[model samples]
Target chain A: MRSGYYKETIVEHINLTDSTLQRAWIGIGLLLVIAAPFHFEFYGLSLITLMMITAIGAMGLNVLTGWTGLISLGQTAFMVLGAYAYAISTESWGWPPLLGFVLAGIVPAIASVIVGVPSLRLTGLYLAITTLASAFIVNHLVLEFDGLTNGSSGIFVNRPVIFGYAFDTDAKFYYLTAGFGILTILACLNLRRSRIGRALIAIRDNDNAARVMGIDLRAYKLYAFVASSFIVGISGALYGIFLSFVTVDGFPFLLAIEALAILIVGGMGSIAGAILGAVFLVGLPEVTSFVFSWMGSSAQSLLSTSAHEIKGLLYGLIIILFLRLQPHGLMGLWQDARRTWTLWPLKY
Target chain B: MNYLAELLASGLAVGAVYGLIAMSFAIIYKSTGLLNFAQGEMGMIIAYVAWSISTSVDGNPFIVALGSIGFAVLFALAVERIVIRPMMSEPILSQIMVTIGLSVIFRSAIILIWDGLPHNMAIASGNQLVDLGGVRVRAAQIAVLVALFAAIAGMWAFFRYSRFGVAMRAVASDDATAQLMGVSSGKVQMAAWAAAAVLSGVAGVLFAIAYELSPSLYALGLKAFPATILGGLDAVIGSAVGGLIIGVTENLVGGYISSGLKEVAGFVIIILILMVRPYGLFGEKRIERL
Candidate 1:
């Protein structure tokens, strides 16, 4: 029993060290940011932008799944809501682009309330199926609501204009998206430290125990839904505006799964995991495709022919490989590296 | 009146297919605690492969369908061996994600080959029709009903009479106890997957005939999900029965009420059924750990 208490103290000490590691990571991130612009080509800049968008979405889903333990298969639904909200509000309604971006998040937040109210009763796979239905509903609505969504022809989004500045180039969006990425990471960190986050973690680890602790499971679960949907919405708006179009063709249920995979591979329950996840899961494919493009005709043609088909297969393989061999994901791998480096002379 | 019967008949045909899809879901859940999200996609892949083989060499439709069924059995074994085996003790969410990833791979591969075009093709059966009372039922729909009936019988026999089937029942009730009895629970889980794949393959081909073979057919994943929820996730028979009910009610609602609200009706019933009986109509109430 004394040993158990000692173990708990060590665990707490390790958690404190993990926070310090995060600060070190931030230092590394700033250094990378400083070096990146000077060294980046078009593909490099685009890769960073893609990673930022992916990190934002994965972080949003991390709250829902990693923290709240609501296994959703439909974060893409919120994303679709955000994208369309951005497209229609900015391009169609003549609303200010900035406000449209904000609305992108607001719309999904409202929609999550509607969906989550019915859905909060469901646990585990039932909850997943509920969200799956929502994803289908959203997909069908987007396609059929052509009168508003422009049907399957797609919605064209205008470039982001804040005050008078327009972010049209990859480099420009990279900076903006990266800024948003930093803010989002900060928000997620703050949320993690907040009371609501603690309640959520309690519910995730044990719903009944949390309920016994005077934590309202329903309220916290809905909070997860809202928070997840809001972040997914913002990411969607960023994606749509950055691309200057919104299409149902791209935002399928797969996006939700892919985001989850990224979250898992990066670390199911960490901010640094979110970063490593977005970079590895989302950035890996882009880098792979870019490499293919550079290999000239044969490789380019092969990638063009099969790239879409291979992405999911590769992501699945990565997640499964990591889970079986390294369940702690990238963070676990990082820990192993640190331990080895710190113990270099002993060779332990 | 004829039109109404025809629609009812088609609804029954389609609903049976949905029932089969739901049954595939139910069977896997009964044996292993997994909600295999790839079940529908598995069906789609088998259907496409069968269609490809049949149309490619102009092979006898019978031979092609049989080949496809055989392939699906092997496919299930391979999937279980690779994806499901390693993650036996993995979290429920991760197990489900493996299926989700497989679903995407299946959908995209179908597209890469089929190029997203809808295919309207006859199955092993021709365009024969029979008049039942005043209703004209298509031959393919009849085939679907027959396939579903045969599937139900096959499952019943395997579960009730056969030793392996009985062992599967034991495993389904509790894998550890079954393992204690020396009935290799892993083998039972693999067999259950094989059975699900066969059901999915048959349902896929028939449903492909009922609705044209479109790449968008993967979207039908959720069409069976509501049925599974209504029937009870672990109740195999419940899947079939719930599917028929959902099918008839949906078509009737679409016929009587606004068609736009058809999905809403299906979902509402699902909610009601789930709330009223989470174990579903035929499912045994499971004891949850506190």
Candidate 2:
């Protein structure tokens, strides 16, 4: 149990030597992820795929709000930009699928720098409000530019084809999203140990102190915004492909709030928390529907009509309850349980 | 000329509503050092309460408005005690998230209860146009202007003369010093929330009178952000002026530019202002210490 506990050197510490049990658990988890589509039905597979897509976005948000201490209410706007970027480049301009995907991430990164330049000067709630305003502005622009975006009617997106293969089926798309999700997780994990990530954490902790320590506050913040928006934009592109349609309505303001909720509920500043939160929150509606089915026909009917509102209420309640009772979120609870289990025979 | 005059008059009326909401935002920020995102929702829920009262019992505007404002005070007090007070020790980010959570809960609850449909109150002379020379305005617009003036005077007098209000201002400036001076920061915070609720309640009720009460009314609360930002987050009077500026700009944009641009005009102005003056026009420049 303590094999990896004591590290002698900085390299060993940075390398994160996993114990045998930890490695086995990770291997099993990876296996399950790869085998999920084969075991689950179409509906279940699609739901999991959706959760993975949401996890990608949540990870992006965690980079900004959780790690950097910057609050953005315009995450959905970046997602919209990415979705539209991908859709237009691929469908309108006849660009290749791979290049279009890359542009999806790049577009939102550029937009983030545009918004970040003016608004990053202000911190806390002011930054939040600015982000919120940016979301509205982005949505309005999408609606106004009917020629490019097709207005409220929306545009259809073809399933992404790379090289010679097309990811058209739900099962195939699930693997595509999973591959990206794992890459995002690995990227975030690497970022946490990198110099840039340390600078961002420093800025988040105290910008003035960070500046005193010779960290460029503006530059690091812009980097955080760029990294966060870039990942979120990719997630948005995946979301567009998942729906096979791109519309402003798909990227509502509530979705931004949902991303924030994921960070809070899963555990802020924890990479594992992002994935856990995404699955829990994304799967919550389905869980509620199943319970509603057991209740009776009346409950099921209510679920169909007021599901969105009910889900919103639950999300709100969960956020408040978690903040009040479990500030560290589900990840905190998991860690505590693991510690207890690991030290079963010892008091300490 | 008449068309422009009519637009300006309407803009002033709507701006007054924004000012009232902005004042509500400023009060909370001033005293608690926390931004209440749910400020607009508080007014919205109260306005819905007013609508229900007018529909079920009596259509008397006075009774409806007074009852709702009374309810608003209790609601705000409860929220402070239940949600805000417990969160005093948390990080500012957690507190902000709490308010955002509160907003979502309030909005969703409103939808669950009222079913997301817009409701019209039978109290105000809603559509009746009162002509002032070359300009014509709705009676509700006149009521809105009256309410804004009344609110501003009431806030001024309270801050000037009232003991609690003075304590709130003290706490806003410096809490530890005020605490040493025997003014309970908790009570001041509670009072701030309650005072903000009153301002928002009046604004919401007036808004319902001029327009209609709906779940989306919370968006109007969001619009007040630009006002608060423009006026400076901590300046009550500044927010009011900012509200007027945003209202007129939005109106002119709608009248001249595409109607779509009207909704985002205030936001665009706020971005411009933040670029030039992060502290806002009338806001006190805050000096931070390491």
Candidate 3:
């Protein structure tokens, strides 16, 4: 039943073998991506690293807000769970970093099961309240739990050591973070092809009809919530490993809003869009806004204090303007451009 | 026992300010289904204007008070006409984003102007203290309660039988039908925003009168969000009532439990309330059809 539906819906848009002309475009994209790492070196490496982390988080959000149509503001909270979970489990408990990272995802997945089971029944804005409250809860918890998290004072993280080799530099970490980012994107893309993904789409578009079609909404919804939480958690872990510090302020309502911005700017319900949104929305602004505004500010204040607030404000405005002009987001615009340019030489 | 009385006294004073902010929140939501995320920030900007106006007006404290309220109202109206009105018809998410952007802009602008300084104003400078059973309460706190009541009563009277309020109701129900019924919803929407601005005016006055005004005062928007959640998103009465509930509960928690837990406790209550009564205490639920 679903394969037929997929054929009807997606196959009509792109037939792989019929892409004789489009294949050149595909090759060009691959050439750029492959050449990107060597030409830009660490700049390309770190940018892709940041983009990967953001994309992972956006993918989690895409499932919740994009696919399931559940509004959430707890994206950063889940990320914090992964971050703090890794920080404590590895640094304090002496677990290896890899095991600690896996635990990070598990921690938030467990939390979503606890938080989602009750909160999912409410529709629209009311459910939004629950997520908002959860964000506040996480922020406070991270601050108040001085015993584990060091409270608002924050806990510092050390670089990860893999098999006696410490990944100290950004380049070393970029390889690891980018690798995880790619794996996450592939997993998310594959998941979108599965029955679980369709059920989520059905639930997002219409819950009652999905239920009528024998979609176990309660199960699928919970699964999407947990899966998204897990991915966000992993992103959080990467952030801690990336920056080597975790504070109550590390995860904020702004992260969730930025994620919302990315989703809106990237177009919902597409994996490629998540990557596009994350890179264009988060990475682009992170690089340009930081570099352009660096004029005379001290490097300490640049990365540490002032830059955070300035970058956040810029991201917020960019998301709003992008959404206003590109309602379907940048991805939607890209597809439109391709279609319009197809017969430019002659009016077909 | 004295602790309870003292808590109530301070709680009422603080609750009045939250109530005022929530009132503006409710008015905007009731008229237009937008949450106006910038409402709290608007209150902060208005409070700053009040501070500036009071200083520029005169040395006489009463005139300063009036000037503060006046400037706040004008600022709110300007904000409505400029930033908010353009966003009144977009998607809820878009409206929210615009408001968030406006909030960032407003806060940054205030920082540029004010340089993050806290203002000290004696809005209640008579040195009059009312003694109730050995408890000497500041005259200003009592005045706050009275002002809130008077404002609520004025709102009640205006909305109860006023022509504009009735038309606003018609617009709220169905904009097209209201327009056909000779009610210009655009004007109504604009008026609704104006009324919300006025409420923000009253709130900024109450806030400035009681507490110090600073750039961070914008954080109250997130704080008042709980009041909207607890009282019901679109309930004007609930906004007032929600204000008091949050104020009292927050103070009580701060006083008895721990001051550090104040913000967290409020949100925790919101989560529990949403889990049980998701539409809020008095919020109306409308099922959406795609």
Q: Report iRMS (Å) of candidate 2.
A: 2.2
TM-score against native, each model: 0.89, 0.97, 0.88
Off by over 4 Å in 1: A1-28, A34-43, A142-148, A164-170, A290-296, A344-348, B52-62, B111-124, B129-136, B253-276, B287-290
lDDT of each candidate versus the true structure: 0.81, 0.89, 0.76
Tell me what fraction of the real C-alpha contacts between chains A and B each candidate also makes. 0.24, 0.59, 0.34
DockQ of each model against the real complex? 0.40, 0.61, 0.44
Docking class of 3: acceptable
When only chain A is evaluated, what TM-score does every model earn?
0.88, 0.96, 0.84
Itemize residue pairs with steric clashes in candidate 3: none
Q: Taking the tens digit of each residue's C-alpha lDDT, what string does model 2 give over B1-34?
A: 9889988998999999999999999999989889
Leading candidate by lDDT: 2
The 10 consecutive residues of candidate 3 chain A with the worst lDDT sum are A1-10
Q: Write the per-residue lDDT of candidate 3 for residues A1-348, one digit (tens) a residue.
A: 121224455655433334466778867865765555566776667777777788888988898888888878778889989999999998889999889988999999998887888786775555666777888887777777789888877778898887788888876787677668767876786777678988899998889999999998789989999989999899999987766888867776678888887888899777778888888865765565567656555653544544555665677567657756676788899987866677465544
